[model samples]
Target chain A: MNPPILEIRHLDLQLGGFRLADFNLEVAGGECVALMGPSGCGKTTLLETICGLHRPAAGTIHLAGRDITHLPPGTRGIGLVPQDIALFPSLTVAEQLAFGPKLHRWPPGETRERVLSLAKALDLTSLLGRGLHGLSGGEARRVALGRALALRPRLLCLDEALSGLDETLHGEILAVIRDAIRREGVTALHVTHSSAEAAAIADRVVRMQARVPDAGERDLTANPPNGRWRHRSSGPPPGPEVGRC
Target chain B: MPSSPPAPSHPWRTRPELPFLLFLAAVLLGYLGLLVALVAANILTVSPAQALEVLRNPDIIHSIRLTFFTCTATAALSVLIATPIGYLLSRFRFPGRMLIDTLLDIPILLPPLVIGLSLLILFNRITPSSCCLVLGGTLALATLVGWLAVLPRSAPPAPAILTTLGLVSLTLLATAWFTRHSTASLETLAGDRFGLPMTFQPLGIVLAQLPVAAAFAIRTLRTTFDQISPRYEAVALTLGCNRGQAFTRVVLPLAGRGVLAAGTLAWARALGEFGPVLVFAGATRGRTEVLATSVFLEINIGNLPGAAAISLMMILLAVAVLLLVRLFAGNPPPSGQ
Candidate 1:
């Protein structure tokens, strides 16, 4: 059997006072896993660490069966769609989509074709010429997703993928996301707080608990049990059965 | 009750406040007019031809060249240095970050002459290499300590405090030991070591202007960096940009206008830097004499027309710079509230 597309073992990451320890997970090739946790849990941090933004204090991260623990984000072959939909304000949607491909030294024609295909997929065809500043939140999110998918990444990490949207729009975007992931055949690790979001697009679900207690909790100074809070599998994914639009 | 006849309109309630606004406007205009009138009076006393003649004077021309070039250099250097410093202050959260930020503002609040004097004293007492050594050592040590404190788990408070004190003492000792051999003043040392005159040299003028100019640049760029969302850089990173590429492609392009605006403001401030220049770089006939000191020299020598000509030149230059900055930066967007 092929090794998992993205594998993390015994990951320990600390940013400031917050600590995420002994994290272990694996996603098989082309699998979509939903990581749901409460606020202040290490969901975003783990996504970042996998993307090579944060260095793990301990443990190894493997992509395509190769250790990429010390690799820079640019070389990680992992695309990230952050919660804020951080579209580059200075670039048109077309330029934004082309950015990754161009950086990877793709030929002009190929880059343009890829950008156009992604734009079409994400319903960003009309807004390709528009700067990000004037985009509506929904449009911005779509463009951001398109940008992340432009490089045809081996792994895609989504932080709060269905957040800050109305319920109606959420279902629409999730359908688009599911279709795109299937088309690209990319492994995905989606982080969201909503259980419905987890059920809609994931083949499996996992949960991480906050290692540090919330502010004003009794055990402020006390270390977390066994140097980890929780890394429990929350059962199988429902796979887009939750009121698909 | 007939709604009390709809209530008679009070004068204050019905008024447009035009009179009050006009009064404030008059005060504002009067203050501006006072400056214009003074400059105008000076221009009036000197004919166009006389001003042209003053401009043609070799000494005055030299001063103008020195002023323009040094101020430009100061602005460029400051902006170059401030970009990374401002970025770090805006993006990173380390211990004593606030303290570093407050220290950046010291030159701005300091009297200009004091800034010059401080530089003068520093150069006089400490060799440049010595100064650099002490500063570099402290920074490297502090960063090492900071990293060790945070990473591998936070260190206990007692060791951290003791480590900080130890580093500080070591730095002080190093600085003192380095300065011990430098008995000669900056002027004498420069003449002996480099055979370049320190006082009244154009280089001294740049050194004097740097503190004030860099303070302004740092502050302006810090505000610019603060206004920029860090997520833009993050997006760039995830889009296959390394740190340098992310800054150059994403952050720099977004901040282009702010950088231009900050450079213009710093250049203007440096152009008008008089007190520091006077203290560090003395006013000589041709060398080290800038437009500000030229005006001072002319006034001292009872050359009213000459001073007036220089004043008019400065005003014209200031207006030109303002126009250029407006053209490039587009009014700076009212800064973040």
Candidate 2:
């Protein structure tokens, strides 16, 4: 009962036709969770609402114990790894790492030291001078991760963060991320449709069924659940982010 | 890894009307050469030094300097002010945006002289600002500053200066209008009638040019935006950078060259603005006499050599500026496009 690091309760995001109805989630401090759902099952909308990018039509989202429902994304200390790995093309790898702290007006010396350390840790020390013109998929993802980590966010939301990564690099990235999380005690909510990724990275997984209109839908809660799922007293934990729409 | 041999060149796969590029270049060069030859035939032969002596006449130099000073000042002012307007036009949608966009092009399409007349009719003897009595006084320098043309006969240089400066401003405005490259009959658009002192006055030239420069800058900025990728912005925002910081750190760097090109084009358009300056600022011998107006004067009033010499100087100055622009315009951060 460490204050829930992230929480979404009875959320209803009305995006025209589809409604993300009855969505409830919570992640404990220093814990990781995975959200497994189909393509259009409101996974992204949920994450965006958590990140304060989208406003829920009828719901409350508590992040780090603050009611951040109406806050802009920048005010909330949630880091998002979008699906497309939206790295700034105009910046060099090093500049990308410096982007966040520079905006927050951190001391230049500390920012520089942090950038160098992160570059070395991420194996981007040599690529410091490299411009972000045409990066291989893996390199871009790492740069993107470094950019997110620069903010030192309380929660890391990865929206299909590993989708574009090559298989060979995927294991390594996951391992790097796992180690970083353990070292920093940062909470993560990873979103993906891939079971292999869930099995590899998630401590626990929540199953999400597509929220179709309940005109004649069956009550899923009445039946014994088919797949293996561990339920929290409140609900499931937050997961990875979706690409910014 | 050894590089694979180059893939066989596509025979028909890559055809994209590219052959027309060289044809376009050739046609442009040939036309330019023909124009140069025509100018050469029209002028009396004179050495560069003799031409310099003729130019050394205080009267001629004064006229030339007035043209240079006014046009340069007007153009510079127009460009600096127009950038934000241009950026807004391309990026944002608001009420009256379309009307303002259309209104900006009027001075450019109409002859500079007509604009000057309209501006004059609006301002002095009628416009409230003109009722202030400052414009009508002899010390107002109406010929030089140009809002009041009621004293058109007091100075030999007032009308001509008004026409030249007016035309320069109008053309600057026109260049801005055309830069958008919209197929909307850009010229046929009329503006709100404030009956301001801009028309029929040298100020009209400045006024005329201001909107045109804005239009061109808008077009330039639009093209710049088209080449940018939002991925960079996405990255910065996710990294805790706000919109302003992200724009400065990410968008501007990659768009630097394009931005530079826009500014340079705007400046060049300002410098060479002629038709509007001719009609609005007028072809006065010493008042609003820009290079183009001087050329016009020499051709019409027996100073062919002076006109040719001034034209040549203008060409050299323009080439120098064009060269400077090219040199610096190639270094912006790589576009994700």
Candidate 1 segments whose C-alpha is farther than 4 A from its true place: A1-4, A7-10, A21-28, A36-42, A90-94, A106-113, A116-140, A161-172, A193-199, A204-245, B1-58, B121-198, B304-309, B312-316, B319-337
lDDT of candidate 2 over A131-181, digit per residue (tens): 876677777778777777777888888888888667888988887776666
lDDT of 2 by residue, B243-302 (tens): 667677767766666666666666566656666566555666655566666677777878
State the lDDT at B103 in candidate 1. Answer: 90
Interface RMSD of each: 4.8, 8.8
Instruction: Tell me the lDDT of model 1 at A115.
Output: 90
Candidate 1 residue-wise lDDT, B266-305, digit = tens:
8988888988889888898888899999999999999989
What residue pairs are clashing in model 1? A200-A240
Candidate of highest DockQ: 1
Candidate topping lDDT: 1
Residues A98-183, candidate 1: write the lDDT tens digits: 99999989999999999989988888899988876668767887888888988888999998867879988888888988998888
The Cα error of candidate 1 at residue B332, in Å, is: 7.0
